[model samples]
Target chain A: MLQYVLKRLGIAILVAVTVSMITFSMIYLSGDPAIALAGETATQEDIQNIRRVYGYDQPIVVQYANWLWNALQGDFGQSHYLKKPVADVIFERLPTTMLLGACALIFALVLSIPLGVVAAVRPNSLIDRIALTIAVVGQAMPSFWFALTMMLWLGIYWRLLPISGTASWANFVMPSIALGYYITPAVMRLTRAGMLEVLSSDYIRTARAKGLRPMTVLFKHALRNAIIPVVSLAAVQFGFMLGGSIVIETIFAVNGLGFLAWESIQRADLPMMQAIVLVLSFFYIILTFLADMLNAWLDPRIRVM
Target chain B: MAERVLEVEDLCVEIPIPSGMLRPVQHVSFHVGQGETLAIVGESGCGKSLTSLAIMDLLPSKAKRRAERLVLDGDALTGMTERQMADIRGNQMSMIFQEPMTSLNPAYTIGNQLTEAMLRHKSVSLAEAKDRAVWLLEKVGITAARSRLGQYPHQLSGGLRQRVMIAMALMCGPDMIIADEPTTALDVTIQAQILHLLAELQDEFHMGMILITHDLGVVARVADRVAVMYAGQFVETGTAAQIFDSPTHPYTQGLLECIPIPGKTERGAHLGSIPGIVPSLVGEIRGCHFAGRCPYVHEACTAEDVSLRPSLDAGHEYRCVLSPQAAIANRNKQAAQ
Candidate 1:
């Protein structure tokens, strides 16, 4: 088990390094960073001075090494627009995004797992149709549109929520719903399909033949096996929620890393963009690693392998 | 006779599909006494497994199981609610399935699956259940039983897992066990061992067993009574000796002839075979279900339904148009020709 975990961790580190390298290359890929940093009116000499000051004149290998060394120490350089340390700006906004991501995931699982199980338990029944309709609507409607509708009704009309700030937990209700509901369809469908398959398995027959309570058979035996793949899906969705929160953050003024990313892109703050992309990519890799571990723990077949 | 552990009468299972209502098990009835093994032998899709599942009240949701009476030790299972049936299941009666590789939950440890039934039905503590699990596992011939408890299903081989399944079925100490093709998925060598273990355990526990299988050899070796089923009905049923020695029904006789008789059958000669496939049970099924395949099939055979009729021997019966004497004379005439 320990060796499996160590191996997963090694792969995770390899992925993070590749992501970091890609994030670092984004600056070069977008043409000269010095030219982008300097004003359009600036002469060649001005561009050269900017390049020298930022050490862009050095070979690409040395430049990458220096940036990687500093990034290793959490020194992500300064934001060109805000004139603040990139890491500070990113870390400051990270908590809200993380909290939002966690809540969104919780809401998605809490709402969809039972729905999926119920739908699967009695397929083609009324409740199953209702759940399927909800899933279809959730999948069809765009998140931004859903967010706007919620903001209009809950924030403007009903005065039920504070829709545009991260002052309290209540502020996240609309955004989380919009973000979480978007992926609920996939998660719920996977769960329903999985449960349907697992519920028909010989083990479930054995479980029923054992005279286990319906709840025990459904939750303990059937769900435990069915939820394995869903766990990995949920992890991937969580990573997606974190990265895709840019639109929601923009609309609600949550001021998370997503909003920071939008601002940096617009203002040509390459350092902040690099840090945000790298950080989010790292989160994605780490989440996938944890999911692998969790799956291995849940299913012994994977553990022995 | 020993005390009757189970009495099922006129049990029918019908499944409705897009085409029509499919009657897979038609008015099948049998009883099993304490410590007796009544093996229901048939080809695949002959509704043998469905009969066992119907008795256990575990049919698919859409499939309707109707029975005149399903009594387990004086308890009427037909009218019991699902909750009441659940209480009786795995307590008064339990089942063992064919595929041990898939019968045990992969995510759970052998210990959890073994003890869960006992824990649910009895008021015993977890420790007590665990102890019973260990004892049962060892009784089923699994060595290092205590260590085997913590291991998951995939950790064990097919044979070992089947032993665990047998141990699990015995955990609650039910009076009746319905083993549906229990050794069908086992290795050839392992098949004998599993059968031996089951026989030993049944003897020790004195539980009435309904052994469902397609293996005539298994039925001959272990079954006290045997029911030969065709399509959705029992074509013949009697003491094992009667069915094997003097199979009166054309279907039963044909089945026995298919098996090679060691030195009796020529080494390179053609083996016996019953011509034609089983008829579909959809819509209305007239006459004997095996009429198409029976060598003596006549015009009248397909004109009406065939029901089980008694032979000269007590408790022996077969479903055929001809009388026992006539059927035997006809077989002898054919053999002489």
Candidate 2:
């Protein structure tokens, strides 16, 4: 197991490096970085000074090497607009994003799994129809619209909860729901399909024949095997949630990494944008890698494969 | 005391299809006595497995089951609630299914599944359950029984997994065991070994067993009595010797003839086979279910249902129109004339 993890870590480093290379090049792909950094109204000498200071005169490979070496030493340079370290800017808002993401995931799984299981238990029943309808609605309707509706109904009309800001739990209710609603369908549908398949397997029949309690048969014998693929799907969805939080964050005024990312892009803060992209990509790759390993551990057959 | 383990009468299972209801097992009746091994023999799709599932009350939720009576240990199972049925299922009776490759859960260790029923049905401690699991495993001839407990189903070979399944069935010391084609997926050698183990264990525990198989050789060896099933009903039933030596129903005769007798028949002799198709189960079945497939099928045979009639022997019985001896004589006389 240790060897397996070490091998995966090696591959993860290579993937992270590749991601960094791409995000770094993306900023350079647009108009001259020196002009963008100096502003459109800057004089020619100012543009030259900015270019020389940032080593834009160096060859592309040399420039990339310099940035990469500095990045390894925890220096992604200062954000042009904020005049602060890119890491400090993104990190300041990390906790809020993490809290929102975690709560949304918990909410999605807690509600969706049972719904999926109920639907699978009695396919085409009234409950099954209700779950499918909810899944379809969740997948089809945009979260921004859903967010606005929640804001109108719960915030403005009922005054049950606060509309904006992440000051307290009451304020968090709308944003979490808006973000979590989008992925509920995927988790629910996968659970239902997985449960359906597992419920028919011979082991399930054996479990029934053994006279296990109905709940025990469904949850213990059936759900464990059913949740294998769902785990990987959950990890992928979590990563998407991290990246997808941008729009929801902007709407809710949750000052998080996603909102920072949006600010960095609009202001063309190249280093800040580069740092956010690199960090998010690193998280995505690490999550997928961990999911794969967890999957192998869940089912030994995959290890051999 | 004449101990009766299981008794079923007029048990039927019907599933709803696009065209309507399909009766896979219709009006099936049988009884199992203590220390008895009744072999239910039939070809594929003959509803043998379906009968066992119906008895276990584990039939597919969509399929409907009806029975005049289903009793186990004098307890009527016909009207029992699912909870009541579950209480008796692994406690008083259990099932050993075919295909050991899939019968055991891959996610669980052998010990966990084996100890489950014992723990559920009896007030046993965890340590006691583990001990019983080890004992049962050793009883089924699995070496290093305690160590095998930690292994998953896929970690073991097919034969070993089957042994584990058999041991699992024996965990609670059930009064009855329904083994549906227990050795069908095993190699011939392993098949013999497993059957031997089952027979030995059954005798030791005095457990009534229903062995369902399509192999005549398996029936001839371990069965005390044999019931030949065809398309959801029994065509013939008698002592093992009587069913083999004097098969009255054409279906039973054809099934016996299909088995090659190595020492009796010539080496190059053409193996016997019954031609034609098994009648469909859909729509109302008005006659013998095997009439269309029987070589001696007369118009009278297909006109109405034929129920079981007693043979000359005190206990032997078969479902047919002709008397046992008369049917054999009539066929012989036809050849002479």
Candidate 3:
């Protein structure tokens, strides 16, 4: 087990390094970085001076090495627009994004697992049909449109929730629903399919013949095997939630890393954009790694190798 | 005679398809006594497995089971609620299924699944359940039973897994066991070993057993009484010796002819076979179900419904229009040729 974990960690580190290299080269891909840093109205001498001061005149490999060295030390240089360290801006807003992502994941799992299990219990029954309809609606409805609908109903008319901001748990209600609902259909459909397959398996029949209570047969015998793949899917979806919260964050005015990304893109803040991409990619890689370990622990067959 | 453990009378199972209601098991009834093995023998798709499943009340949701009487040790099972039935199941009666490769749950340890039925049906502590699991595992002939309990299903071989299944069925010391094709999925050598183990266990526990299989050799060796089923109904039923010596029904005669008797059948010669597929049971079935496939099918055979009639031998019955003596004479004449 220790060896398997170390091997996974090695692969995760490799992916992080590759992502960092890509982020570093993105600024150079769009014409000259000096002109962009110095502004369009700057004279040629000012451009040359900016290039020299920022080490743009150095070899590309040398510049990349220097940037990587500083990034390793948690120093991502200053944001051109905010005139503050890029790392400080990111760290300040990260907690909000993490909180939103975690809550949305919890909500999605809590709602979808039982729905999936019930739907599979009696296929084509009333509750099964209702669950399937919910899954379809959740999949078809766009997140932005759903967000706006919730804001109009809950925030403007009924006045049930504060639609915008990240002040308290109440503030997260509308935004989390909009973000969490987007992935509910995928998780729910997977769980339903898995449960259906497991329910028909010979072991399940043996479990029934053993006269296990309905709940014990369903949850302990059936659901335990059915929930393995769902765990990995949830991990990958949580990573997407963290990175894909840009549109929802902007609409709700929750100043998280996604909002910071939007602001940096509009103002041409290259250093801040690079840092955000690098950080988000790292989170994605780490999450996938954790999912693999968890799956191995749950299923002994996978741990044999 | 030993005390009756399980008794069924006029049991039927119907399933609805697009065409019509499929009566797979029609008016089948039998009884098993303590320390006795009643083998239900038939070809594939002959409702042998359905009979056992119906007794367990584990039929699919769409299928319906109706029985005039289903009693276990004088307790009526027909009118019992599902909760009450569950208490009886795996406690008073248990089941062993075919396909040991998939019968045990892959995610659980042998000890967990083995102890589950005992713990659920009895008010036993966890430690007591574990000890029972170990004892049963050893009883089924597994070496190092204590260490084997910690292993998952995939870690064990198919034969070992089947032994574990047998051990699990005996965990609660039930009065009756319904094993559906228990050794059908095993290798030839392993099949004998498993059967030997099962017979030994039944003798030790004196539990009534309903063994469902399609192999005549298995029935001859293990069964106290044999019921030959064809197309949803029993064509013949008798003691093993009576059925083998004088098979009165044409279908039963055809089945006996299909096997290669040792030192009797010619070497490298074509073995006898019962031609024609089993007719569909989707609609109203008239006369004998095997009329179309029987060689001696006469006009009067298909004129009306055929029911079980007593043969010359006491306690032996077969479904046929021909007299028992006449049927036996025809089979003897055919063998003489």
Evaluated on chain B only, what are the TM-scores of all the candidate structures, in order? 0.98, 0.97, 0.99
Candidate 2 lDDT by residue in tens digits, B183-224: 999999999999999999999999999999999999999999
Q: Higher-lDDT candidate among 1 and 3?
A: 3
Q: List the residue pairs that clash in candidate 1.
A: B287-B304
Q: By TM-score, is 2 or 3 better? A: 3
lDDT of 2 by residue, A220-273 (tens): 899888988888898888888887799899888888888988988899888998
Score every model by TM-score. Answer: 0.98, 0.96, 0.97
DockQ of each: 0.91, 0.69, 0.80
Better of 1 and 2 by TM-score: 1
Which tens-of-lDDT digit does each residue in B178-272 have in candidate 1? 89999999999999999988888898899999999999999998999999988989989999999988889888887887888788878887767
DockQ top scorer: 1
Tens-digit per-residue lDDT, B1-337, candidate 3: 8999999999999999999999999999889999999999999999999999999999998999999999999999998888998898888999999999999999889999999999999999989999998998888899999999889999999999999999999989999999899999999999998998999999999999999999999999999999999999988999998899889988888899989988989899677798999999998888889988988889988899989999989868999999999889989887787
The per-prediction tally of clashing pairs is 1, 0, 0
Per-residue lDDT of A27-130 in model 3, one digit per residue for the tens?
Answer: 99998999988887999999999999889999999999999999999999999889999999999999999999998999999999999999999899999899
In terms of TM-score, the best-performing candidate is 1
Encode model 1's per-residue lDDT on A1-305: one tens digit a residue: 88899989999999888888888899999888899888899999999999999999999889889999999999999888898998999899999999989989999999999999999999999999999999999988988899999999999999999988988889999988888898899999999999999999999999999999999999999998999999999999999889889998898898887888888889888999999998899899989998999999889888875
* TM-score, chain A, candidate 3: 0.97
